[model samples]
Target: MKYLKPWRSDGGGLLHLTILLSLAGLRLDLDLDLCLLLPPPTLLRDELLLGCDPTSPAYALSPYPAPGGWGRADQLHPKGREADPAAPPEGQLLREVRALGVPFIPRTRVDAWLVHRVAAGDADGAHGLLGAAAASSAGGVGAGVDGGSQAAPGGGGDPRASPSSPLAARQEEKAPAEQTARVPDADGRASEENEVLRERHEAVDHSSQHEENEQRVSAQEEKSLQQKNEDENKTADKPDWEAEKTTESRNERHLNGTDTSFSMEDLFQLLSSSQPENSVEGISLGDIPALPGSSNDGMNSSAHYNVNFSQAISHDVNLHEAMLLCPDNTFRRDPVVRTSQPQEPFLQLNSHTTNAEQSLPVANLTAFLPFVDNQMRNLTSEDFLHDLNINIFDEINLMSLATGDLDAMEVSQLFQEPDSDSGLSLNSSHNSTSITKSNTSHSICEEGATGYSSDPESLPHHNLEGAVGGNYPAPMGHRSDSGFCGDLAFQHVFHNHTYHLEPRALESNSESFSWPEKPEKMSRYLSDTERNLSRDERRAKALRIPFSVDEIVRMPVDSFNSMLSRHYLTDLQVSLIRDIRRRGKNKVAAQNCRRRKMDIILNLEEDVCNLQAKKETLKRERAQCNKAINIMKQKLHHLYHDVFSRLRDDEGRPVNPNQYALQYSHDGSVLIVPKELVTSGHKKENRKRKREGIEDGFH
Candidate 1:
C-alpha cells in the first residue's frame, strides 16, 4: 500500500514577517518564528533512520523528496506481486519492470540470487542488496543478464555492445528462419523439447526456493509490523504518553508562528537587536514630561498639580504657585464678618490695604478631602478595612510609669536646681534646707517617743517593710493607730492620692519655678496622730507570731488529707514517695542492715575457709587410716602364718585339730569374725572369736 500524504503548516504571523523581509530587505525583527518554519533537511531524516530495520518499519515513509530533490526509497516499501508462469524464471521474475522498453527485455533488474539472500537474511544480505540496487540503477547491462553470466559466455559479443542494433537487420533476417525452424521433425523436436523441459524444471525449482524465502521474509516483516503497531497503540494509551502528546499538540498550536526551541538567552538577544535603532523613535528618559513647575513653557502652568488640602487639584493660576510657596495659608480661611445693614463697621487700622490683602486665609479644602473620604468609605464598606484605635495610656499606667517606687525626697533632688558647686547645700537660708531640718527633727522626736531607732539612710528599708506590714503580724511593742488619718488629714491624703503626681512633675515644676529639696518635711505638716506610722513603725510595733508548733503540724496533716481527698498531689510527688516504707526504722534499719551484711560476708568467708580446712583434714585422715589398716592386716597375716606353721609339721598344711582363738578387750568391745569361721564354729566359739577379732583389729 503506497499512500502519499502532504503535511503543511500554516504560517500566519511568521510567514507574513518573513515575506515582508524578503520583499523589503529589512534586517529587523527576526524572531524564532521565522526560524521555526524552515523545513528540516533530507540528510537529517536519512541519518535518523539509516540504521533502521526494513523488516520492522517504525515510521511511515516521507512523501516529500529528500532535501536535495533526490528521489528517495524507504526501507518500508510495499512487497511486489508474483510474475507469470510463462516467464522463464517463474517466481524468479519478481515484478515486471519497464524502462527504455523493448520486447523480450527484462524488467528493471534486481539480482534474483541477491533478493533471495536478503529474504533469507544471509550474513551478506544487506551488502548484496545495496550492491545490486546500486548496479541496477547505474544502468549496467551486466546487471540485467541472467545470473550475471552473459558477459562470461563464449556467445558474448563486444562488452560495450549497444542494445539497439546494427544487430536489428541481422535479427530481422534470422527472425523468419527462427520461426521456420520450429516446423516439426518428430524425434529431433521431442529431444529439443525434453532438453528445454529439463532446463525449465531446474529454473522452476530455483524460483520455488526463492518464493519460499520471500514468503518467510514477508511473514517476519509482517509480524514485526504488527508488534510495532501494538507497541505504538500501547504507548498512545499510557496516561503520561497521552499527556505528553496533548501538551505537544497544544504547544504546536499555541506557538504556531513562534519557535519554542530558542533558549532564554537567544530570545533576549533577538529582542534586544530587534529594538529600534534611533533614540528618538524609542522611549527615552528625556521624552518623559518634567514635573509641573519644572517646565520652561510659561503657558504650561503648574495649576493642574496644585492640590488643595481636600485632595482636589486646582486650576486657579496664582493659587497653584501660592500653594507651593505658602503651604500654611492654603486650607485655613480668614473669618469674614457680614454687616446687617448697609452701614460699614469702623476700620480697626489706617487704610493701608492692597490687592494681596483681599485674599486672606486662603481656603482650599480640595487637597486631602478625597483621601479622607476614601478612608471613611473603605471602613464602611470593606470587611478587610479596620478603623483601629489604640489607647496608649491603657497599655502603661501613667503614674507608676512616671513615679517609680522611690523616696519622694530623693527623687525630688533629681528634679531640683543644683547649687553653684553642683552639690546640695545645707544652708538654712534655702527653703530646701529648712524643710529637711524640720523632717529630721520630726523623725527624731517620733523615734524618741516610740522607743524606735531611726536612721536617715534606712528610709528604703522602712518603705519596703511598711508595704508588707498589713499582711504580717505586728511585731514588738508598736500598734497601729486607727485615728492616725483623721477626716481632715485623710482628705488631704485622699486628694494627694487622687491627684496622681509623677517623679518628673517636680522636674517640670522646677522648670516652672523652684522646688523644695526636702519632700519628706511636707509630710511632717500632718498631725502627730496622722504621722503615727513612721518608717520605724514596724520596728517600734509588736508582732505576735500567729504560727504555733501545733498549728504548723496540723496544717501539713490537714493539707495532706485535703490533697489526698482531692487527688491534688502531682505525679512528681507520687513518684518520690511511692516506694517509702511507712513503718521502717529509717536510720537504725539502714545501720543494722549494713552491719548484718558485713556479718554475712564475714561468715561466708569463715565458712569457705572451714570447708577448705575440712577438705584437707579429710584427705590427711584418709591417708593415716589407710596406713593403720594396712599395719593391722600385716599383723593378722603374721599371726596366721605362725599359727599355721606350728600346726603343720614342716608342711604348709594343718595336721592336728585346728583351733582359732580371738581375745577381746575388758571394755566389752564386740568383735567381728570372718564369714567362714562364723558359720563353721559353735555359737560360744563364734562369740569368743568375734570378741578376740575386735581386740586384734584394734591392736
Candidate 2:
C-alpha cells in the first residue's frame, strides 16, 4: 500500500499492492500478475524443512528445536526416554502440548538473529555470548549479560552480548573503518557455481519478485543483510565492560531479560520431551506452507542435487513385431516364443517322401522379413509427373478415348487435333487412322525408374551409400525431395518407474552432476522434469555433443555429409545415425508415389469411359455425313440431265451424261473429262504391267 500510494495517481487513479517474499535475507517484491504462472508445493520447501541436518552447514536453519526433541534419530532413539510418561515435565512436554513453553518470537526484539547464526554453525564469538546469555537463571537476556553468574558452556568466558534491535546500530556508528568491512556478494550477483545446478532441493529463490525488492529498497537500505551480520559480529568482539554497558543500555530501553534464558541444555531438554501421538486424519502440527518465492523453499547456499535416470531401451525377439517399437521401453516378462515348436517330420528310407529338417528358428526367419517387404514395395514404378494438377473431367477428354487420369490429357490433345482438321474436305478414312496412331503411342513409352534414371544411383542414391562410403561416386540425377514426418509420441508411466530409480541416485551409482547456485537449477535435479526432456536430447547432453539435434535432423543431405566430413565421428555413431536422412526422405517419397499411382489409375479409367462415348458420337456423325454425301450425288445426277436437255452447244445436243464427268484440279480449274478416258488409262496400265511380266518370264 505504501509503494502504491505514489503510483495511484499515475495509474489511472488505481492502486495495486505487491506481495513481498524474503529468502536468505534477500527481499523480493513481486507483482500480483505473476502468481498465475508459479504454482505451490515445490520440492525445495520440502527438502529445506525435512532434509538438512542442523549442524552440517552454516544455513541449516532448524532454529527452533523439534516438538519433542532437537533430533529424535527420527523417532529411533534407543532409551525411549521421551515416551516415558512418568519421566518428568520435559518428558510429558510433547504429549497433549498446545503451546511452546518459551516466547520464541519476542516483542522487544534483540539481535536474536545473532543466536540463530551461531546455531547455524558460524564459528565466531556469537555462540559463546549466546551460551552465556542462555545460562542466566533470570529467564531473560540482559540479566546475565550484565556481569551475572552465568558462564559459557564451552568454558570460554562470556564475550560482549548486545541488544539486536536499534541499540546495536549506535555501536555500529562508532566502529572503525577497518572493522566495518561490507559483506562480500551482497549485490545479489549470481556466481559460476550458481549456473550449473540451476534447480536444486534447497536453493534460495531469487525470483522476479526478489528482483523487485532490490529495486524498492535500493535507496532506503544502505547495508545489506549480510553486512548487518558482519557488523553485529564485530560489535560482539568488544570488551567485557562495553558488553556490560550494552546490557545497561538495553535495560534502560525497558527490554526484559527474557532472551538470555535459552541454552544447550534447553535444546537437549526440548529433544527429550514426549512426542505427540499420530492422527488418522494425517494432520501434522509442523506443516507451514511456503509461497513460491519464500525463504523456506530455497534458502541454502549449498543446495543438494538429486540425480535423474532414464528408462532402459528394450529389444523384443519376436519376429512379427520386431520392426515395431516396444510398448514399454523396457523388456516385458514374456518368454521368447509364442507357441511350442512343431514336431519334426519323419522320413522313409527307400523311394519314399523324405522330410526336411524342422523349420528354421523364428529368430533366423525374422532377419529376412524386412528385405522381402522392401523388394515387394520396390516393384512399384516411379511416378515422375505426379504433382501436376489437371482437370480429370475435361469435355475434350470425354470426347476422346476411355483413358483414365494419366492419359486424359493426351487423349484430349489428340481429339482436339482431329476436330481442327475435320472442317477440311478430307476423306473420313484419313482422320480415323491418325486418331488410332496417337492413342497407341501414348500408352507404350516412358514406363519406370529406368526412364527417369538410367542406373540405380539415380533412384535417390540407393546404391551410392556403399560406393560413397568407400570412394568418390559419379555425379547422379537431380535429387527428389522425399522427406516425410510422422507423429512422434513418447510416454513414461510414473507407476513403478519413479521410486525404482531414486535409490540409484541416492547410492551415487550414476555420474555426478555439478550443482549450480542459481534457484532455477533446482529443476535439473528433479527426475520428473528431467524425464520430460527429449530422450535423444538427454542422450546428446550425456554424450556432450557439440552440435544440436535439430541441425542433424533438418539439414540437407549434402550439408549433413559436409558436416560429417568436418568432424571425425566414431564408427558406432556413423552407423547409428546414417539412416536418419534416408528413412525420412523415403517415407515422403512413398506417400507421393502412392498418390500419383492412384491418380493415374483413376484418370485412365475415366479416359477409357470417355473414349467409348466418343466412339458412339463419331459413329453417329459418320452416318450423317454418308447420308448427306448420297443426297448430294443424287442432286448432281438430276442437275446433269436437266443441263443436257437445255444444252445449246455447237451441235445443240446434250453432252453425253454417262460418258463425260466434271473434274476439279488442285489449281481450282474446272474441266470436262470423259469418264471413259479415266477408265482407259487404268486398264491400259494394268495391261502393260501384265505384258511386261510375260516378257520378262519368256526371257
Which candidate gets the maximum TM-score versus the true structure? 2
The TM-scores of all predictions, comma-separated, are: 0.15, 0.21
Best by lDDT: 1
What are the lDDT figures for the candidates, one per model? Answer: 0.25, 0.24
Candidate 1, position 427, lDDT: 23
Cα RMSD, model 1? 51.1
lDDT tens string, model 1, 265-369?
232243234332211111110011111222322113222112221111111111111211122222121112111000111110001011133221211212222
63-147, model 2: which lDDT tens digit per residue?
1111221111111111111111111122122221213222121100111222122224432332222221111111111111212
- Worst lDDT run of 10 residues, candidate 1, spans 341-350
* Count of clashing pairs, candidate 2: 44
Off by over 4 Å in 1: 1-588, 648-678, 682-699
